[model samples]
Target: MPKFAETIFQIMKKFFLSTTVLAIIACLLWATPFTAIKIGLKYTTPLQFAGLRFFLSGLIILPFIKDFRVKVKEASKRWRFVLWVALLQTTFLYGLFYTGISYVPGALGAMLIGAQPLFAAIMAHIMLRNDKMSWQKVFAILLGLSGVCIISLGRADFVFTTTIPIGVGILLLNNIVGSTGNVIVSRDAKNMPPRVLASFSMIIGGAMLLLFSIPIEHPNWTAVHPGEYYISLGWLAMVSALAITIWFGLLGREGVKVSNLNTWKFIIPIFGACLSWLVLPNENPDTISLIGMFVIACSLLLVNFLNRRAQKAQVRLSSMASH
Candidate 1:
């Protein structure tokens, strides 16, 4: 093969592979959780279900890692950050997530979680000096917020009554907590092995949830059906193990910003909505909700494109200076 043609073929091949990997990871992280969480809720209280799932998720990966004890001691020295991550990411985030999903449709619940990237961008802009929010990002943030609002109002006659507001509030809180956790993880958790960090933080957070759940939720251990219990455990564990490790790895990767990677997460709702429609037919979103999804998608694309272009321009300027 000619050298130029060979180069073109290699570039195409790399693009295809990378695209395929990203799609698979995105689906796993976003799509499967909606259906899985809905199914899991049928057999257990929200807190107990979330607690056990995450604890086991961490435990599942603990065995594969070597010298984690030494790492644990290192982590202990930075216990404040580690515990803070546990509290924000696992404890507060999943506690609200499990509870909110119980009160809303799977698709709506997932869409609310989809707004997390907006929160992540805003948080990164505030916290990370290098990731300051540009005018384009600020506009994108507003657009994304509007999309979420559209979805929320579309569900009812704009009446904030009963469980609707509570569910929405909880899901929104989940986004804030989860986004804060992302920023912290990017800042602090990058030093540890990604798997070790994922495992320990999950266990810490899950333990807190379980301790609170026993007294508050008062879950009857025997009441859960064996099949439902196992299935929920299995699905949640897989998500925790796979999605989270990949997430931490991505965050720690060189040149990856919390905002840049998170912008891609806006598509979660689209994937989640489709999956919910297929698996939980009753949770199908209406016309207005679909329109909201489209708006969010556009906002995400705009933010990501602008950010990438800015990064490339900065690189070119850096190259010119070196010359």
Candidate 2:
């Protein structure tokens, strides 16, 4: 290879292996399932499908865990915390998410899900003593909300007449529920093994969703599904298993800052919206929606910039104090 090309390859290799890049990969994996979920929902009811996906995801993680039975036994002592996470994170969050996605275009659904971090920041501000809201964070939240509003307005015709508004509301609620789950895990799961917690909570949550679906959705198990349906389900389960596992590993790594790692999630909407537009037959870019996406993307960038600046200032102050 030419010297210049070799140099570029080395740089790319290092970048790809970095913790930040791994987080981005996890987010990318997460972004993929929105499309798969939409496809699977076409052939099955949302609750039943979600239940199966999560159930399978939990099972998939079991084989990777060493001394799985011991871990599960230990984790069982914290059953209440596990159950709380199960209910809020898997069951409620995804139950609402799958149902809401059914009513919106895939691109729009991706954008709404991408707004999760904005809600998360607010939740952290309110719940965590050390994570108080800064002026920059407040401004970013407003900008993020404006982007969401713009996205909703882009669907003006369907907003009132169809179920679009209801779907949007449900999705926003899903973000809040997911954010609450994050806070709970951060505060309470300090001693819990993430793998065990992830596995059992998903299994329990999945079972609950299945039980709820039987009475509520009246799913038709006898009906034959297309190959695409199974494919979508399998992919979604794998995405859930792989992405969550990677994220947990990243979080446990030494010297990895959680906030800095999480900032990579900003790319989820970018990849998700683009993928939906490219793959979903019914989804295409609208000028207004694109503008909304750009605004949201900018808000994420601004927040990330602010966070980096704050971290650098803290480092400088600590050095000065030591001197």
Candidate 3:
């Protein structure tokens, strides 16, 4: 095959993978845990679930991908950024996520985290030299916030006020911190393979968190159940790590924002709400609650509008310079 044909084939492959993988990963990862967290509430405290998620995730995942291990002596020179990214990205981010999951429904937790795309666009707009923002972004942000409010509070005249505020605060922080991590990963890190990056994140983040967990953890060797741990552990690593790693790599190749070009993450709230309601029927998200979720869904769609405008600005500038 000619070089041009090979290049086109590679590009197409990456595009197909990125578009499908990220969304696919998003669905299962979000749904399973939303259910698991509900179950975990029956068995253990939120922090236990949080601690176990990372510790077990690391132990189960590390043996498979040995390539991510950095040499101790040289890491200071070359892989220094990994430490920073891991701490912020995995350490604090997942810690907050699992803790937040304990207090809220899984679907709600995922949508809150998924909202980072909006935050990401702002970071990308400011940090990337070529990606400029327009009025569409401002309107989108405002509309998106409106949607978020509706999801959080709306009910059949029964607002979800006063109860889950802490959960919201935790998820909100996770979104911001995770967005900051994304910007750092995009801007500072070397262009490494995605699997390697994921492995590094899991290892470093898992280890650091373990250190904190060790002192507090009481060995319930008899009481602790392995069945649910295995289930959540397997799904999170395979779906959230391997799949998401592939998705991020595709984003780098196919434009980090291209997923937004389609009706991408706006569906997060839909899947989240439906799955949350279905999977955890005990929580019982009513019609008003569903409508509130619809508002969040619409806001996420509006966030994509910002994505489109940024792309248009790039096109117009390119056309002008061509003259």
Candidate 4:
């Protein structure tokens, strides 16, 4: 029995590591959106973009499912977790985040919204005894923040101005909601299969966004920028919508913020500072940007390691006590 339990643990550990890697790649992939949003802003209002992105992303996801005709109406009825997920992650968070981008720079706005992970880390520690805060995790949080400071000090391109305070405020609200949603997901939605949870959330969220978009039809096709049109659309669909949907599913089960902290381990400040080049072609990411990214990555890795080691130790202690 002990051997079998250990084997299962080992398998789960490996699976988590792989999923963590994929999740990180997805996080980095999302870095491009900072630039894409700048381009997207050139054509559409923030509300318009938010509504369109959700609608388009949801549409893209629907065709890919194997059993599109099949419906599991009972899942949400059986589990109230889906309702909270729909309201927090898809409906409010993205709506505010996408809209906020209209008021702030995409890259900079993305960085500010990073408060989500900070909230995630703290919430995970408080909410889950298994994911207690450790010195190493503290170091990781500090390191990640330090990287952001480095970028702020060096980059003349990103100015923290007053016009966008409202935008930033909205994002902070989004961050709070997003983080709480993650905690709920981690506690309640862990039992559901990842794909099912993800698909359901997206469908619910997309419906909400569409319902809201009707009143704000400022959509003028002539306003669209040819160069950024398809690229921006693709980014919202693949990265922001689909990628985030999968991540929300993962987070609901694994402390989305904590599980996601791995990706932020490096990409936030690095991409935050450097991505101006990809997202904003005229802007340049200096050495300071790269250094900031490196520091943040180191911090997150340290924290993640501490958390994992602590979890392992707790398990061992439990086994000994049982024996």
- Candidate of highest TM-score: 1
Mark the regions of model 2 whose C-alpha exceeds 4 Å error after superposition: 1-19, 102-112, 144-159, 162-169, 248-264, 277-297, 320-323
- Residue 24 lDDT (model 4): 68
In model 4, the clashing pairs are: 35-279, 137-303, 140-299, 185-252, 186-252, 251-256, 265-297
The CA lDDT at 190 in model 3 is 43
The Cα RMSD in angstroms, rounded to one decimal, for candidate 4 relative to the true structure is 5.3
lDDT of 2 by residue, 1-323 (tens): 99999999999999987776788789889878766776888888889999999999999888987898888888878888889999998999989987887777644675687677777777777776756677777677667656765665674443333777888899999999987787777667767677777888888899999988999999998898989999999998888887876765565555444434454676666576678689879878889878877887787688778767888998999999999
Q: Write the per-residue lDDT of candidate 1 for residues 92-143, one digit (tens) a residue.
A: 9989887776666644664587677778988898888877777888788678
| Model 4 TM-score on a 0 to 1 scale | 0.78
Which is the winner by TM-score between candidate 1 and candidate 4?
1
- Candidate 2: lDDT over CA atoms? 0.78
Model 2, residue 281: distance off in Å is 7.5
Candidate order by TM-score, decreasing, is 1, 2, 4, 3
Pairs with backbone N, CA or C atoms under 3 Å apart (clashes), candidate 2: none
Q: Whose lDDT is greatest here?
A: 2
Query: Candidate 3 — which residues are off by over 4 angstroms?
Result: 1-15, 18-28, 41-48, 55-77, 100-118, 121-133, 154-172, 217-226, 257-266, 277-306
lDDT for 14 in candidate 4 is 85
